[model samples]
Target: MFDNVGYRPGRKPQNATQEAIFAFHVALRTGMRSGEVLQLGARTLDVGRRVAVVEHKTQRYTGKPRRVPLLSPAVRLLKPFAVQERIFTIDDADRDALFRKVRDRLMLKHLDFHDSRATALTHMSRKVPVQVLSRISGHKDIRILVNRYYRESAEDIAKRFA
Candidate 1:
């Protein structure tokens, strides 16, 4: 399901470059679900720690929040837009529309914005510790998370183990 993950959907409105890039950059760093990221409040970000404290979509029932580390690039991209209540001004409908327009324009097949989660996971799994990755990804089972998101070569995995 996580195949063909190269193209990241930019958050363009009417083909504008800057806004779209920022939106895409945020999704790329967080690995959060659309609902979770859309509702992510400003308080979630700890600038000093460069981390976003998120309550996983699945964790609404469990009530434990996870600490997701942010890339410096994403922090820079978000800093200008960060507000008192939310990081993104757009709602879910706007997010969906923006992502859909970008996907259609790029002519990508089956590449939904949600796939950005896999993109983030694949990027982080290579370097992040399993425990931390599980927390950030909000996946209680690392096997499912790794199997679904990461398609590493046997040699690459072997090197990781070594």
Candidate 2:
């Protein structure tokens, strides 16, 4: 979908300004929500262990913390952007502004930052099961996830029946 916007799969972003871009790619690759990505702090990531501690948004079913394994690409992108105490900080408004700029720069129309979360879920569904995906996504219910986040293609269904 973003091929026209110069989104090359497995391509690393070039600069600090593109850190968010790199982060976005990592989020999608790891099936993380945008809020989870935004809330990441220095203590959240353990580069040596290649793990990330994620605080799930207080939802009914999932009120505790969960851990996500970091991929090599995500680790590489995050190391340079990591600060002493804070990993990444941006206010809500600033986040929105940044999203707008990134969307425009990428020539994406009507795409919001939160959409990245959806994209991540959609893409990762093929590789992982709903149960594992729910853990990473912090979704309270698997049914909600199946209904909302997981994107199924008609071809996928046809192939299943065939």
User: Per-prediction TM-score, please?
Assistant: 0.73, 0.70
Best candidate (score: TM-score): 1
True lDDT of residue 11, candidate 1:
24
Error of 2 at 103 (Å): 1.6
Question: Candidate 2 clashing pairs?
Answer: none
In terms of TM-score, how similar is model 1 to the real structure?
0.73
- List candidate 1 stretches off by more than 4 Å: 1-21, 155-162
Looking at model 2, residue 78 earns an lDDT score of: 66
Please, what are the lDDT tens digits per residue for candidate 2 over residues 35-89? 6676666778787787778776673456656787776766776665454465445
Model 1, range 1-162, lDDT digits (tens) per residue?
A: 111223233322223332333455578887777766665557887766777777666677778777777777667655554544775667667767766766676677688777888888878878787777777777888898878876567897898789
lDDT of 2: 0.65
